[model samples]
Target chain A: MDFEDFYATSKDACLRAVMATVGSRQLAEETVAEAFARAWASWPKLSAHPAPRAWIVRTALNVHVSWWRRWRREVPAVEWTDPIQPPPDDDLPDPRLMAALRTLPPRQRQVIALRIFLDLDTETTARTLGIAPGTVTAHLARATAALRACLAPTTGQE
Target chain B: MTQDLHALVREEFQRVRLTDTLDDVTARGLRVRRRRRSGSVLSAVFALALASGVALSLPPGRAEPDSVRLAAWSVRTEPDGTLQIVIRDLADPDGLTAELKRAGVPALIEFKEVEAVTEPGRLAPHCADDGEVRSPLLLSVMVRPTGTDKRAWAIRPDAMPPGTSMHFVIFSVRDAAGKSYESVHMSLVDGDPVPCRSVS
Candidate 1:
């Protein structure tokens, strides 16, 4: 598809995937803008990539990992006390799951976000995050275990 | 337990609400391209202005050396569109925001020192004559506003020969939209009244 169409259709989806990875709306917004601007600058090169979505997602991820952004708040996990009124898109993860996801290491959080939120397979997730496929598996495994434990009801009811 | 975990994790994304914006991104993408063109044109103008400024200092008979000196903080626009503003003291410069307003830019510009650094050698000669600042004064030049939605760029105090502190002016832009964005444009100067050079 053309750049405008690609942007209209994929921008929000791409951002949500990144939001799940970065966990901060403002930072996510900035990252998305930077990536899209770069994409526009070199659309010819990027449009030809084998997996354009993967490239866009990877570009957003690269912005998150930038050294300057390293100075951003180091929250272990985000805490959401109230459920946001459902947006037009009814599909939102439970806050408990979001909190649990945030507690994971940033790398692990990114891996799980790509795998679960974007449904990227192992190789694609690995490519987007610039990690080895084996590393993706390890992170996924650990992240899955962590989420399971963290979200498990303490009373053993859930 | 593993099966249950997978189910719960997968469910989390099912109702995921996204917060990305397309309109703003689309607008910004276009602006980014235009800025590159403006930057190049401005560079050429700056070169021409610099060359002619030294050679054609004053017009023939009516020219006076007295006309050359200007107060620090006088706003001037380079051939390329960067606005050069001077910071003489701390608080808001009395007429700066107003002057900038007249330039078609809606801005509330002020100076807050993260750390104090003083350099007086660069002041405009006019300040010395008026005893406004003597011996050492900052440079001042004429600056004009070029457009709306212009990003506020800063000139950091340039490296001094000796005994001067080094600090950079940081211009953080908070547009009407209430979203703060930093332009790639930045300036580094040796002292006050230095050109707010465009580094982009």
Candidate 2:
């Protein structure tokens, strides 16, 4: 499909995917814009591919990950948390939960994002991350366990 | 933590709306591509202007200077419209042939020796008023249209004495039907000639 059609059909999904990976709205926006630019350059070559949307999404993710790594080299990772928003309250509110999520490891964050935010299955998440399905399952397991622990006290699971 | 985390992640994901706008993305992409095209055009125009200024400043003597030797070569094509040619100083006749062969062109290019034109001296009076001498020798090759009106030429910078300025010219030609294409000129100066290369 043409660029306009591609943007219309895939923009929301692409943005969500990037947001999940990068953990910042500004970075997500930048990465999505860059991905779309790259896709525009290769539109003629990618149009004939079987799944152009997937191609663009994968490209955007890769770009975001690469930028994340590069930026990591320049800046200390000690305070790698999202600066745009604050942590959640003791209550099980949506914003609080997101604040807590911003504390997870990068890979764990991406696993949760791709699986839950983008609503991709284990296999698709694994493929998107270029990892084995078992690896994806392991990351998801660790993420779920951590999140569960963080929410237990609030829900009176103790 | 699971329920809270899930809701939080969902909200965060929801907070991010798609912004890969066609108007913005495509506009930026097209702008970059057009910028590159314009850069090359500007470079070419600058080169042409420089070359014209150099050509205009030359002395208009009636005959080639005696200090330099001259040579000319032409190739004619059949009905199919394919012509190949190589021209250089007669002293270096085999050099051009060897170069063409090394470049994987056909061995039967059939180099022809036509009457020599007045050999412009590689050294000429400088543009400055100090009466400084400069080298500006030129060598040219042409693929003349046998029956058609098209003509292509490749002119090389003349090898003049030391301290002389060197100049080169390149050109291209197309047939009436536009199906036939030919390299009119690929030129070089002072030292060995390099192929056409562009950056940017």
Error of 2 at A41 (Å): 2.2
In TM-score terms, which candidate is top?
1
Q: In model 1, where do residues sit more than 4 Å from their true spots?
A: A26-30, A62-92, A154-158, B1-7, B17-24, B39-200
Deviation of model 1 at A97, angstroms: 1.4
How accurate locally is residue B199 in candidate 2, as Cα lDDT from 0 to 100? Answer: 13
Q: What is the lDDT of residue B97 in candidate 1?
A: 54
TM-score of each: 0.50, 0.43
lDDT tens string, model 2, B1-200? 45566665565455446544577888656644654575586567668879888542212211122212122333323234323342322223244344333433222122122221223542111111222221223222222111111122222112233332222221122223443222211222333333222110
What lDDT is reached at residue B129 by model 1? Answer: 17
Worst 10 residues of 1 chain B by lDDT: B124-133
Q: Per-residue error at A76 for model 1, in Å?
A: 24
Residues B1-200 of candidate 1 have per-residue lDDT tens digits of 76567666665555443344556666666666665665675567668889888542221111112122222244454445544554322333335556554543333343322221223442111101111111111121111111122322222122123332112223333434455433221111222233232221
Candidate 2: lDDT of A32? Answer: 74
- Candidate 1 versus the native: TM-score? 0.50
Which stretches of model 2 miss by more than 4 angstroms?
A: A48-54, A65-95, A152-158, B1-8, B31-200
